[model samples]
Structures are given as structure tokens and as C-alpha cells.
Target: MATKMVGFVWAFLIIIGIIYALLSGNISAINDSILTNANKALELFLNILPIIVLWTGILKIAEGSGLLDKFSSLLKPGLSKLFPSVPKDNKALGYISSNIVANMLGLGSAATPAGLKAMQELQTINHKKDEASAAMITFLVLNTAGVTIIPTTILALRIAYNSSSPSIIIIPAILATASSSIAGLTLDYYIRKRNK
Candidate 1:
């Protein structure tokens, strides 16, 4: 369904672009827009890389210092309620903690591996071959709606575009993420309850 929607959107955009090109009697503007967007995207990527590397390194150091482990331990009781099938000492707990920590710091690239590891571990505990387990679904919801403290990617783009006070977006980012997280968790709980 999502793929179909994407296809429809792209097709509509192409058709609209063609109509605009014909009515405006200029295909050059389309080419110019494409080139400009591509250049802006490249600039944004370059600007973000340094921040990504720096944050990932910091997270690595924190991981080595056992800070992430401590954070995991602190959250373990609550997490256990969400993932009852997983043992307290399970590697998935570690991965989930690291992923959440990285995300909180707005280091998504750094978090990807840990998130994947957590998902894989969750899958291993799932007995059904074709369907995802309740824990897996809940984890997915938590991740999708996870709160971001810094919103590093957006801040990088804003800085690249010469925005003043890029850090000001942090409050809004927190609010948006908090709302989504609450909604996603609520829906997940409702669905799981219904399933039972």
C-alpha cells in the first residue's frame, strides 16, 4: 500500500512538472531546480558528516566507560515490562539501551547497528516463523516514535542554510517526539491488549 502511494505521488509529480514545463515554455527551470536541490542535498550531507563522526566517537567512548550499561540497568525494570520474554542479562537489552541512548543524543547513524542487533535478538525469541511477536511490534513502535533530544540532522541542515539559533529547534523537536512516542506506545499497548 505504501509503495503504491509512493508510486502515485512520483507519477503525479512528474505529470505536474511536465504540465508546468509546457505552460511556462521553459524546461530549463526544472533542470535548474533539480541541480539546485541536488547541490543543496550534497552540501547538507557534507555539513552533517563531521557532527555524525564526532557524536559517534563520543558515544563509543561512553559505551567503553560502561555508561550505556548503567543507563540500561536503570531502565531495565521498565524495559522488562515491555520485553518480558527477554532475560535481564540478554544482549538485546544492551543493544536496545545503546540504541536509545544514541537516539536521545541524535546520533542515528551510530544507533543503527544497535537497533538492528536488538531486532535480531527479539526475532530469535519469536517462535512464529511468519509473524512478528508482540515484543517485536512494541519495539518497532518505540523506535519509530522515539524521542530525540538534539535533532542533529535538522540542526545541521539549518546551519548549512545559515539559520540563526539552530539549536532553538530542540524544544519543538522534543515536544514532537514526545507526543509521537506517547501516541505510539498507547496504540501498541491497545493492540497488544486486544491480541491477548
Candidate 2:
């Protein structure tokens, strides 16, 4: 369904763009636009790829050094409250904590592996494999909403663009993410309560 929706939107946009370009007698601009956007995408990828690689390497080191274990331990108490359905000794908690930490620091690429591991662990505990469990739903809500602290990717992009004050966005991003996290948690809690 989502794939279909995306395809529909893309087709609609392309059709509209072509029609507008022809009507404006700037059909040549359509080809130029495509080429320009393709170049911009490549330029953007080149700028962000290094940051992703560096952070992914750092995450690997953290895991190897047992830093992730310590970090997970620190987050365990609070995580238990948020994910009460998950067993206290569950391995998923560690991965969930690691995923959250990586996301906060804006290492989304690094977080993916841990998040996948977490989901796999969660599935083991799920009695109904067909439907999402409460814990899984809560975890997904928190993960998707994000509680970004560093916003490293955004900062990196800003730097690439030579922003006057790249770091200025840090506080705002933190506040915004915090708000989203709060709202998401609140809604999840309310939904769980109502369901029960």
C-alpha cells in the first residue's frame, strides 16, 4: 500500500512538472532540472557519507570495548519503565538502548544494526508473530519519534553548506526532538492504558 502510494505521488509529480514545463515553453528546463537534482543528490551523498562511516566505526569500537554494555546498563532502569513488557534480562533492551543512544548522537546509519537486532529479539518474545506486541509498538514509537541530542548529521550538512553558525541548530533540534519524544510516549501510554 505504501509503495503504491509513493509510486502514485512520484508519477503525479513528474506528470505535473512536465506539463508545467511544456506550457511555460521551458521544456528544456525539465532535463536541466533532472540533471541538476541528480548532481545535487550525489554532492549531498559525498558530504554525508564520511560522517556515516566514521560514526558506524565508532559504534563498532564502542561495542568491542564493552562501552555499549555499560551504556545499556545505565539506561536499563529507565528502559524497564518504558518497556515493562520486555523481560528485565532481555538482550533486546541492550540493543534498544544502543539504538536510542546512536540516534540521539545522530548516527542513524550506526543505529540501524542495533535496531534490527532489537526487533529480532522482540519477535522471539512475541506470542503472536502476526501482530505487533505492546512492547514492539512502544519501541517503534520511541525510535521513530527520536530524542536527538547532538543532531550530528544535521550539523554536518550545515557545515557542508558553510552555514554562518552550524552549531546554532543544536539547541533547537534537541528541544524539538524532546517534544516529539514526550508526545509520542504520552500517546503510547494513553493507548496502552485504554487498550487494557
Question: What overall lDDT goes with each candidate model?
Answer: 0.82, 0.86
Question: What TM-score against the true fold does each predicted structure earn?
Answer: 0.81, 0.84
Predicted structure 1: lDDT: 0.82
lDDT of 2 by residue, 130-159 (tens): 999999989988899987777657777998
Model 2 CA lDDT for position 180? 87
On the 0 to 100 scale, the lDDT of residue 39 in model 2 is 88
The clash count for each model shown is 0, 0
> Ten-residue segment with the worst summed lDDT in candidate 1?
68-77
The runs of at least 3 residues in candidate 2 whose Cα sits more than 4 Å from the true structure, single-residue gaps closed, are: 1-12, 23-26, 53-61
lDDT of 1 by residue, 1-196 (tens): 8799999999999889978997998888887887798888787789988777777787788779988678767876788777777887788877887778778877777688989999898888889967888888888787878888877677777888799888998988799989998898888889878878
RMSD for all candidates, in order, please. Answer: 3.2, 2.5
